[model samples]
Target: MKTTSSLSRILILVSALLMVSAYFTPLWQISLWAPQYPEGLNMKIWIDRLSGDVDIINGVNHYIGMKHIGQEMFPELQYLVYVFGAIIAFGVLAAILAKRWALYTYLLLLLILGLGVLVDMYLWGYDYGHNLDPSAAIKVPGMAYQPPLIGYKELLNFLAYSGPDTGGWILGASVLLAGLASFREFRAK
Candidate 1:
């Protein structure tokens, strides 16, 4: 009979709870630093909203003609919370089923979700960076201000860094925990 160890089930449940907690934390953050603004500007992206120095960031972006970084710009915000809720539910069901197949399916879903998020972020960055207005105040002959997806980049005089926030770290740990559970179940089989 196909089965999952009790420990594996516990791990899956724990991961699910951790993901739920991520709903209350910032999932991603983008920061910008320049000589004029020694303090740096930060924008934190939550599951359903944005926080931190958004207004300031928008004001700065205005000079370069980048689209305003606002909640209205991201339709995903309207339904992303529901998507995560469903993923968490899948995890809970996987734990309750206590079957190797269920755990593997949950792991697969997590992988897909992670990849999809990265692709989406990259696309958004591309559009924002490439779609500059002809009437912008600052225009480099062939420069695009696309920020790094997961690291540091220099754009003009500013240093931009993009990476996961507290919630992202928790979610990453949760994914790893789930992976461990999957590996254990695979070994048991």
Candidate 2:
């Protein structure tokens, strides 16, 4: 009978546990700073909702013609909970089954899901930044307010910083652990 390595099993289990953190913590965060508001405005994006200064952010966005920020606006919020649950379930199964292919499949799915999220976020940002209403109050002749995918961007006087938050880092660590397990498994074979 073939058996999986103890390290691989442990890593998969740990990864599964870490993924649970995503549900409770914000996955991404964007902060805007200007001279007028020294403390800055923050927006946290979770798998299912938005938090932190949402009303203020929406008010500012209105002038620039960006869509009002709201949980109802995101369709993904409806299904992401189930998706993460499934990922966690699959990770646990992969560990318990101790099958190489099972772990590989989980890792592959995780990678695809991760990429999909980035694409979705970019599209969302693109739509908000580019589809400005003709009558917007704060129109710059050729300016778009698209937030950076993973860094800093300047929108007029505001400096926007975008990056993965705590949950995002956890998810990333989960993936890394899974990857390391896969690598070790492959090397052992």
In model 2, the Cα lDDT at residue 25 comes to 98
The root-mean-square deviation over C-alpha atoms between each candidate and the true structure, in angstroms, is: 0.9, 1.1
Candidate 1 on 150-174: residue-level lDDT in tens?
9999988999999999999999988
TM-scores of the models, in the given order? 0.97, 0.97
Each model's C-alpha lDDT? 0.91, 0.91
Residue 130, candidate 2: C-alpha displacement in angstroms: 0.3
For 5-71, candidate 2 gives per-residue lDDT tens digits of 9999999999888999988999999899989878999999998999998899898889988888898
State model 1's lDDT.
0.91
lDDT of 2: 0.91
Cα displacement (angstroms), candidate 2, residue 158, comes to 0.4
